[model samples]
Target: MDDLDLPTAAPATIEEFRDRLTEITDGLPRRLRQCADHIAANIDRIAVSTVAELAAGADVPPSAVMRFCQILGYSGFSEMQKLFREAYAPGFPDYSTRLKNLKDGGAGSPSALLAEFIEAGRLSLEALAKSADETALAQAVSVLAGADMVHVIGLRRAFPVATYLAYVFEKMSVPAMLHDGVGKLDRRHALRAGDAVLAITFAPYSEETIALAQDARDRGLPVVALTDRPTSPL
Candidate 1:
């Protein structure tokens, strides 16, 4: 909520923009906050979306959308769009095609794909090692180890990891329950006084996971969250 009298430098990268957004969004006025939320949630569409479309999605006027962009240090919407367009250049193959080819087992060699996946996993582990808090990790371990039961929940892309955790817990003779939201079931009722929650989610988090975690917190149950960043609402 500055005076908006001075021009600000634009963030150099999309990741930098996200870091800045996380830093400033909570302090913004309601309309601008809506713009931030909408943009963050639908980031992949930014290069193709118009000012009017973004405004409509945010339920704000076009002027507010422009102002939101300005607040993020863009001269206007075009400058912001330029950044995204450069990141998602038209020259590269789209993700869907690559995924389809992988599914068909026809485009890339298996060894190449295996190397790619292994490299990705290695990088992810390195990033986690750099950012993880040792004390917090120990606390989480203690909490889950002591809980009467651990309720695990993750959906969409996070579903596989959550299911794997639940499976491992069971094999180790540790009590665990997975809230898969099957048939849209409301499993928040399964949370109990002595239970803990292990919530795994990422950006644009699943609402059901957040709700269940919140419910567990409200009941004074311990909640260990595995999410993307500190700013995430897990």
Candidate 2:
């Protein structure tokens, strides 16, 4: 059969997915194992949902879902689902079976759970360390440090990060503004040339953040973005 016509198969039950998860993550860290469990439990729903919708259904952040996909040897959720659909050709594993395997697979000890958590964190940091661009990070920091006025914009969940950056910059004697909330018009009025705007946004990019960044750019401000994707609107 052609790739598209391959019968779309997923674990019929969460229990069967858990069993396969164990085999796939035999040597993985504890946190990742737990994340795998989360994915297994929700894979059926997630396979057919958008990233944002899947994250909400899984009760985890979108980044977590993306990270889980990466762990499963897929570039992202879309690719992961293609493999999942292909693998479960005849039929999907039963949900009850998958859950049973998860319940039965553990030692039920705090120490064991703790070990898994630590290992997961270790693996996550290692992966990030290997992938991060130090040069780009340095350039971003330099831009912030030397800016005449720093305008920070983050919408939705990213708003907290922008607020924290504004607070920290204040403490450091750097001129920064966190323009969020209803009073953004007043803040926007204050932007000027030679200023730098550090925008933090993610997919399903925030319209307000994009607007502000665009406005700043029109006024000759330098725009630097911190986003999940390199091609984000900001």
Candidate 3:
């Protein structure tokens, strides 16, 4: 297998981390592959897993876990663990413990479920606001406005955002094209240099979207992507 070079920066989100991990699974050594499989299958446990503990669960040695972390551009297992913890677990009792608490709720009511959902949404929005880069958002809007035509490409988890962007652009009388890539048809031939592409994708990224984004860049299109991390192929 060829050596994989990970981005220098930590992944911006857990979904982006998974996308990169999926890319390397087929090329990993057998022990590392086991580690990958275990991590993917048991995301809920990853936040709390130690190098030794996770290695034991995956039936690999601690050294293999370290090697896996190094291949992903981390100093060691702990650095990578920190990113996952921040993304999904957020430093508290583990998810299973929380679920157990919910089941054993001593002071519960019908409205408690509603409160739980509302609180979850509030926390999610706060996290998003905290993580947002104002400069980046400004640059994105500027670039989109400057393009001759804006092409939006996203599939699976990102499709709704892509469609909404195209819809909004059309409403404003902007020249916009949404590439749903139905049946994986050939669409790159239609793109030109003056166009801008707004691509959105996360974990298990749509291969078709990545390929099209690459095509746009190769043809000199300015691609403004909304992705979980810099490593997103788009």
Every candidate's lDDT: 0.82, 0.66, 0.78
Cα deviation of 49, candidate 1, in Å: 20
Q: What is the lDDT of residue 51 in candidate 3?
A: 82
Indicate whether candidate 2 or candidate 3 has the larger TM-score. 3
lDDT of prediction 1: 0.82
Tens digits of per-residue lDDT for model 1 on 74-119? 8899999998888665423334445566678853677988875665
TM-score order of candidates, top first: 3, 1, 2
- lDDT string for model 2 (71-151, tens) is 544567777666546544323333434445546797378897677556556654553564366777898898888888999
Candidate 2 vs. true structure, TM-score: 0.50
Q: Clash pairs of candidate 3?
A: none
TM-score per model over all chains: 0.58, 0.50, 0.61
Best by lDDT, which number? 1
Ranking by lDDT: 1, 3, 2
